[model samples]
Target: MQVFNVDKEKTLNAALLILNKLGQADYHKIFKILYFAEQQHLKNYGQPLTGDVYQAMPYGPVPSFLYDVFKASENQASPFSEALELSKAFTVSRKDKIPYVSPTREADIDQLAETNIEAIMASIEENYALTFKEITDKSHDSAWAKAEQATETEMSYLDIAESAEASPEILKYISLQAENHNLRIS
Candidate 1:
């Protein structure tokens, strides 16, 4: 598996879009929706939507960087500068011991791709109202199970695509993209 850098601006815009679409939602809802949406995008395209890696968490697959960003929005001390930036877009609060995010403004739609929006919208519609058990079961796919017992296990895009049953041709394309991306950054 190759490593790829995350696009924080695109990620922020994507998360904002989800929050705006869902209004105020709990951490589970936001992260789970993102997890599913990323999987769909990986299957349809050779790339992920947010380009942020996912971690197999108890709730399901959570975007690792966005997890930190959400923690930062919650006013927890974080080394990431995006913490404050995320806080500006979403006000995070706790109710009955569960944390929720409320969008402070509309999403930067110009920053999001049409297919990405479609994936997320479908995920929201499908997953937003699922029971905790339903979502956990749905999200604990092969990819998530691979890292389930590990702490903060970072999931690779290739593994995610594999679990989503992406075609061999698509997987090869994603691998090529990863190589090109690594070469560009390295």
Candidate 2:
């Protein structure tokens, strides 16, 4: 089994990078649950070490970093087996809670959501019970209109958010629009 060795800083950095790249919604939807526990693992491993390995050994190629870490930490006072156990539990919880989808399917859904904001909003309203008033107030209608014009052709929520920074009020509306459609911040 291969294990990846990572220090607390490196582990935390990697996770944060992934979170930033993935956006809040996708991070919450897919990465957060998996990661919060990982954060706990980092917290528990109090000292910096030469190496640590397979925080969890699920049925796959042990991440090289994990394998290296495990191998390096073999003689340490407290190796990563315990943390690996927790990670395993975390993985099991995730696997039992949600099924994995192919990367292609994931990308297709992401593209569709980005390009089809209206439909995405409709679905959000239906599924998450989102409300228009919850997102925008009367004061922001003018700004919203202006932003709407800019975004009439471009379907990216990230673009809309980028362009519509007239005020906090306007930003709220943009956020609501982007969030309703599951748009990632670009």
Best by TM-score: 1
Please give each candidate's TM-score.
0.90, 0.20
Q: List the residue pairs that clash in candidate 1.
A: none
Deviation in Å, model 2, residue 27 alpha carbon: 11
What TM-score would candidate 1 get against the native? 0.90
Predicted structure 2, TM vs. truth: 0.20
Candidate 2, poorest ten consecutive residues by summed lDDT: 99-108
lDDT (0 to 1) per candidate: 0.82, 0.29
